[model samples]
Target: MESSLPSTQILDSGESAEGKNEAKNYNEVMSTLPKVKSLNGYDYYLYQGFWYAPFFLEGLMSVQEHFNPQSTDIFVASFPKTGTTWLKALTFAILTRSRLSGSTTSALLSKLPHDCVPFLEYDLAQNPSNRDLAIPLVSTHVPYSCLPKSIISASCKIIYICRDAKDAFVSLWYFLAKQRRSENVEPLPLEKSFELFCNGIANYGPYWDHLLGYWRASLEFPEKILFLTYEEMKKDTAAHVKKLAEFMGCSFTLEEEEGGEVQMIISLCSFEKLSNLEVNKNGKHRPDTSIAIQNSIYFRKGEIGDWANHLTPEMGARLDDIMDQKLKGSGLKLPR
Candidate 1:
């Protein structure tokens, strides 16, 4: 897969003349309408100078109302592209071992993680009754501050997965690049995109604040939130899955051990396995969006320190300094 944005003559949207022209075009394409308040009461911000509704937040409220939080229910939460799909697959396998009988077949596995543990936002928008489906599993990328108060206070378990900001930015860049290209919007140049990302100007960004919010919450309520790192899980998935199972009160049985079910589950949920599945690649869950483009591409690369290939030395140093300044004394550091 092409990881970097294509280098070519393109309009800019920064301080340069070409960038200003691009900005003008973006503004022209977007409606100059007033921002509207969403049903959940958050202000919708302008995207490309047009009022953009946060359908996701609206869906989240719907799911929140329908969710009957139980001690047994598990929620997987993350910032976008922070190994969410992989974590969802691993968690699903761990929780539903008895149902799967150790299979990751396309016929056996759900088309999307959203189908297995639906995104509280997307599903609720697609089918309001979908909220009732959250009894056992749900996943979200909503910031901790934005999540329902009940989820914060309930006995239900939450697993917050985080990734190094550099890698997360690179992954998000590629993900958005694919989306924009598909939508016929010109792709943002890599350098400018990286700058916007570092400045936390992208969608659902201000990455440090998002991660810190969860980190602090987890510290305050350790029993309710289990903070995890993508690097750690990539290093020893089986061990991590086992640890997760233990935390969620679901463990492999002796009979499952005899059948190597734990290892089977890990392999089944591997990046290569899930990314290649026809169901994952071809299935469509969101209206007007291709599953292959949106969900399947989510698992594009799970490699650690992959950002080194994209971020310049100076850029990396700058990011490191910013992270140090923001995360200082928080007892949290990005995994190497």
Candidate 2:
């Protein structure tokens, strides 16, 4: 058998460049990787058996090289459009509520979740000397397999969120469509994107495989990883918030709950409140990057079964079959 893998590029400190042109260096490295076409009509590179969008590769390299995870650090991990924005908001609000309570201002009052709790990969890319790494509240869309070894070695706690395949697919499609429109590129057709999704070629997809990586990890190390579902969180926001608070080791005291702190957090992090906030509605996450996405782009309907408006019954059934087949015997159940 012949190996067709690209030349190996290990994570390096890049001290020689003094952190200059890191993105260019990463792009040069990416040019050498095995490449494939994605359903979204972009080039994805094959790295360690998983495909990744070229835009994220640079930041991922930064994460691999520089992220020195600590046990006290908390991570919010998820596949794209799986309520990641919402989770970040909730977690940040939960953990920082006490510290920020006395201030006249709130984090969410000015910063979006992506701003308050930055993505590990992209955030590190922008600010290589990130001061917050000591006890960071980081988020990432990277698959579990590709996460920096430091994250696992340091035993950092991770909160992983999963969504039903149908809804996730719908949300991902719209998200990508908006992105393409922002860049003045014609959006990938929905039917074509759906086919690619089923074939396991969408961004960070095979969704089931990505879900299983964390699902199995949570099963193996329940203490290190808390598995969550967007549907479940939406169904009982208060209960899930309590659970998240407990897992983060900052459970609300009875006195606080009695004072309605839980409800306060929920209201502050609510989809309606966050989405409509002037900052989130008009701000840009990273305006200078290749993927200069608006904060408002992350706010869609944020509901269940929006797929019904997009996917036909036959299409839904086909995805269901694929999910059933791929997740067979995995002991993982995504909300329907």
Could you say which candidate leads in lDDT?
2
What tens-digit string does per-residue lDDT give for candidate 2 at 101-145? 532367787877887886776665455455355336888888898
CA lDDT scores, all candidates in order: 0.66, 0.80
Per-residue lDDT tens digits for candidate 1, residues 182-291, read 65666677787777666655545567877888899899888878999999888887778878888888777777778888788888888788778777777655545332
Q: Report the number of clashing residue pairs per model.
A: 2, 0
**Model 2: pairs clashing at backbone N, Cα or C within 3 Å:** none
Instruction: For candidate 2, give the lDDT of residue 170.
Output: 93
Residue 15 Cα positional deviation in candidate 2, in Å, after optimal superposition: 11
Candidate 2 weakest lDDT stretch, 10 residues: 1-10
Q: After superposition, how far is residue 111 of candidate 2 from its true place, in Å?
A: 1.6
Best by TM-score: 2
User: What 10-residue stretch in candidate 1 is worst by lDDT?
Assistant: 1-10
For every candidate, C-alpha RMSD to the true structure in Å: 10.3, 4.7
Clashing pairs in 1: 12-19, 13-19
> Candidate 1 — which residues are off by over 4 angstroms?
1-53, 60-71, 104-110, 125-128, 131-135, 287-295
